[model samples]
Target: MTLSVRRARTNDVPSIHQLLDYYAARGQLLPRSPDELTEHISSFTVINEADNLTGCAALEVFTEDLGEVRSLAVRDAATGGGYGRALVEEIEHNARTIGLRRLMALTYVPDFFARLGYGVVAMNTLPEKVFGVCVTCPKFRCCDEIAVLKHLD
Candidate 1:
């Protein structure tokens, strides 16, 4: 079967949460509540290969000109299978469709994003994210995730 990214469905919540939780448990990502996931499910996308969930991501709009690539995770077994790249491409397409000029991500895998045309950026440059969301994170003062940005065309 062909693998493609699709809008997330409510039924995908459990699997999405499990995939995200796997990363969160290792501090690679922040934990997301099921309620939050359900509430913003419309912002998410998923990749299912032959009925097995391979990966997921969400495009979180931060402002009229900016959007974020959040909750990006690929199943352990699918790490090298291009699922992550596919999800990011879908998020980029969605962001451009919505008229967003920039897409940013705070990622542990900067190289992965860089390969997708994203450039490393200083966290302070994104005040909207730094003040709006990152401030409340437990790792606020010590956040280690690399910030990357891609200007959408």
Candidate 2:
């Protein structure tokens, strides 16, 4: 199957929410409602082979130069097929297009990001994420996700 990544559209919300819920239920990613996905659809990128949605990710800009890679997930059957990497590459492209100089992700799979040039970083180093966003996360006090960052050219 040929996979291609592109900007998300309004009609993709249900599929995106389902894909996110699949990982969220396994505690591999955060859960996002269909409404939330729809509201931020412009920030998302999706990978599909023909009409089947395989993976998705979003670039959440926090500042003029900083953005976070959020809600990255791939279909269980599609994992290891490079769709995840494609989705993130799309996100990085989107971030750079918007003039972001840095991209960060809070992930359980730091190695995946590392393969894409991300480096491990302390959560506290990102106050915009720590105070502005983490404070609202249910796992804030017991967060186990590692923070990873990459500098964009």
Candidate 3:
């Protein structure tokens, strides 16, 4: 695979939204609004193959020691090719570079994150994301997503 990860530009927002929507529609991820995407564009990294965006992920820093990996999605055609892992690795590197002590993700694919060094943790363990975002999420009252965290050195 010639896929490469890079910081997203403003123009990439639409494509990133589309990719996330593709997964959201199928219940693979939560759909984010264009406004939110634009607001957090700098936190994103896209997997590009040639001129196409094959997958995307975002690193949302909550505190000095923590960043959450959210909005991860791989195009259906590109699934099973390690793009998801690549995206998370990219985010993990970003977290480490910024001196975060832990990288977390709330996901339906815990095993995938586990393979990438994340461990299942209690939902309440991440109070920042939980109280900051989950309280407003539709699934907040009955969230089924698994929370995973990877400690950084």
Q: What is the C-alpha lDDT of each candidate?
A: 0.94, 0.92, 0.91
The C-alpha stretches of model 1 lying farther than 4 A from their native spots are none
- Model 3, span 1-153: residue lDDT tens: 466789999999899988888888898798899999999999999989988999999999999898999898888998999898889899989999999999999988999998998999999989999998789999999899999999988
Q: State the RMSD for candidate 1.
A: 0.8
Evaluate model 1: give its lDDT: 0.94
Per-structure clash totals for the candidates = 0, 0, 0
**Model 1: per-residue Cα lDDT over 1-153, one tens digit each:** 888689999989999999999999999999999999999999999999888789999999999999999999999987998888899999999999999999999999999999999999999999999999998999999899999999998
Cα lDDT, model 1, residue 78? 79
Candidate 3, superposed: residue stretches over 4 Å from native: none
Best by lDDT: 1
Write down the lDDT that model 3 would get: 0.91
Model 2 over residues 1-153: C-alpha lDDT tens digits?
Answer: 666788899999999999999899999999999888999999999988889998899999999999999999989997898888888888888888879999999999999999999999999999999999899999999999999999998
TM-score on alpha carbons, each prediction: 0.97, 0.97, 0.95
Q: Pick out the ten consecutive residues of candidate 2 with the lowest summed lDDT.
A: 1-10
